[model samples]
Target: MTASVANDDGPQGLRRGAVGFGGVLFQSITFMAPAIATALSIPLGISYAGGATPLAVILALVACLIAANSIGQLSTHLPSAGSFYTFVSHGIHPKVGFLVAWGFLLGVIVGGPFLALQMGFVVAGTLNAEWGWSNDTWWIWTVLVCVLVFALGYRGITASTRAGLVLGAFEILVFVGISVTLIFQAGSDNTLQVFGTHYANNPDYQGFSGVIAASVFTILAFIGFEQAAPIAEEAHEPRRTVPRAILVSCLAIGAFYILNTYASAVAFGPAKMIGFTADDSNPWQNILARDAWGGIGFLLVFLALVNSIIANQNAANNSSTRTMFAMGRIRLLPPEFGRLNPFGSPMLALCAQLAVSLAVALFLGFHYDPVTGFGLTATILVDIFAPMYILLNVACLMYFWRFRRDEFNVVRHGVLPILGALAFVPAFFAGAGIPAFSFITALPKPLWYAGPIAGIWMVIGVIYLIVLNGRDPDRILETKRVFDEA
Candidate 1:
């Protein structure tokens, strides 16, 4: 798994043993941005699944855990910065690996503006509601935080993961406490029925269909659980650490989502939960927080959201830049992207990521608004992520079957991967609004552009791959090489 050096000044490789299991685990946790998801995603789920949002969350959690198993299994064998890129290249075909690299990078790139816009939107909305401040200041916060993310990331992997650990712990504690309190405060309203299909009351997609529909959105909350895999090279005992971190983060965050959803359903009234997102003026969570803990509770929730975004961006930047560095090291991208600064960071990739994020956030934000722009980017991310996840599962099966046959187990390598891939099928169709199912609702008109945007990005990647292959057919094969493998 040694990286081949072409010359004297080739990539120095990421700082090995820079972080331990705790840092790796928190990197995944923070990247998922639990506080942000709890504050925003629950209401969105409730609107579609009513009181059965908890059930949908549980289903999504199961699917994610299944998918995580495949990712974890792959990480044990190939703990590289390229992550899915490495997994697919060796497990599947090198050409497919290049495509995965392309699509995966698209998810990471757009993920920048997606979280940045949300950070600004959350801050501006909180300030406007609490202190009568202008919401227009969102752009300023967006730009400032983009710079902060770059600065922290450039400092090194240790610094980035350490910051994420502290910030992730605080946000998780805050939300968990609030969720438990909300559940207890519900008193007689609390019931196990929220997890049953009967509570799914969405008028457009009733009962089981409502739960299925909401699962599409609920799955988004699990997007970053595999983030630890990308930084496996920098982590201590990565073969052990990366897999455990992925599984543990998924279970922890899954529990957190269930607790929050249950609390929200019971406290809001199960049948009336569909109205949860109707009144943007009076968010139920904020009102409940204020009622439960006075003014300070409201402020704490807002602070958690802000802290969540910062930590989320920090972890995400780590993953994206390292992956870029890996790709560049192998000549899939320009060599400049592989260069590390004096501080041991992928300097060029970091700069490019933040710059593109800032530019896209400003452009789309000014064209429409922060909220709409955030949604568009998120939609595109989900589109890219769903297919990539399926591909990863297939890669897992092929990797074990082709190369590790002696170690292969049918349950782990075959059935589980197939099940994981199958799990995303319903959600993908519903999210894409393909009209394949009568129960699924179409995406909003404004967000309809997400599909074509993702398609164009993938097509461009194919064209670039074809051109690169024509120049040197074996270049794509370098993606399988791992540097500093444990």
Candidate 2:
């Protein structure tokens, strides 16, 4: 277990101890949440281009790998609590850093609740099937899960990471079982159709636009892999382990998604898979259970869903608190936001995160359908994080340009980051468009464009910083020096 930074008074910086590679790997896997990918991803891919859905995931992974390499490089040099925000601040400009931090914070704060709602939906659905109990409001379940998350999160990162490991392992086991079963069933018929151009050549398909849109959704499965870098301060070898964990996690997630999507396509037959409608709740689970597991399918899927929700909850709790802590340390937020509990956890930050999550869950529970709520939350996530990812990709290029000249090659540092930037740029636009499109259809829109929302938040942070500077310029100067040193 790593000890948190000691604070005589004011905000305590993050602790520096030594979390082993297993802990780092466990935390990374928890952030990835394999079951969440297994449950929601296939339908999202199929809805875009049917059998070609697997290809979209593969493409997305390729793009992410490019970005991950850059991130991996950056982590080795300047491992810190703010993750991308820290990288941007150190490698680029502070204003860009502010935007990245605000953008990522907005994404995680809003996205965390959305993930909680997902957990609630899965839990409620599982319980409904098992006990014949109908919980009409997902808020009820969301609230319960939030309470558990809050308790565990307040206890500290170690507990949360351990819980994540258990849930993540179960998710992997379930996913592997389904994949093996599907592969065996497909036998010789499992061909390359799922990855071929033929699957993408449908007249009814939304074409490039659909693939772009669906890729945004598919990319969500890879979202949290980089989150482990924020807690690098707690890792045994911050430079070495952080980069290794990030690259390993991204590769593992990409491989899992591609394999699972291909397996689903094989089991259903590529042609038939394309026709599967989104109307079926938990379409991925349905496909696997109906085709692969047969007799004990429902039970197997039910258990998987439970683990998925728990894994997501653990991720949400860890990410939100660490992000808040980072923001506080940078003076973008109040010093109180940086305070840790007696147990070495960011208690206030955890509470703040939980409060926001509860508010979203409650509002959505009262006002809209679970699916609609989920859509709105997903949109917010895409809107906020897409730009941050784009920025991070750019930051990676800058980091390589400035610091790693000897190590820099066009393919690894330059070409790859450029490709990653290209890959995520359209996703940013598509995500921005989703809310507007929803409004045109007379549907309730996501809260607002997260880029603009984050912009406003940054302005507020700037205003807060100005006020802090007026009262005590030294604090601001000291913080700036810390960032410079970092």
Q: How high is each candidate's TM-score? A: 0.96, 0.89
In angstroms, the error of model 1 at 304 is 0.3
What lDDT score belongs to each candidate, Candidate 1 first?
0.86, 0.71
What lDDT tens digits, residue by residue, belong to model 1 across residues 422-484? 988776775566667776657886688888888898899999999988998877889888775
Error of 1 at 398 (Å): 1.0
- Pairs with backbone N, CA or C atoms under 3 Å apart (clashes), candidate 2: 4-15, 5-15
Which whole-number lDDT from 0 to 100 does residue 449 have in model 2?
43
What is the TM-score of candidate 1? 0.96
- Index of the highest-TM-score prediction: 1
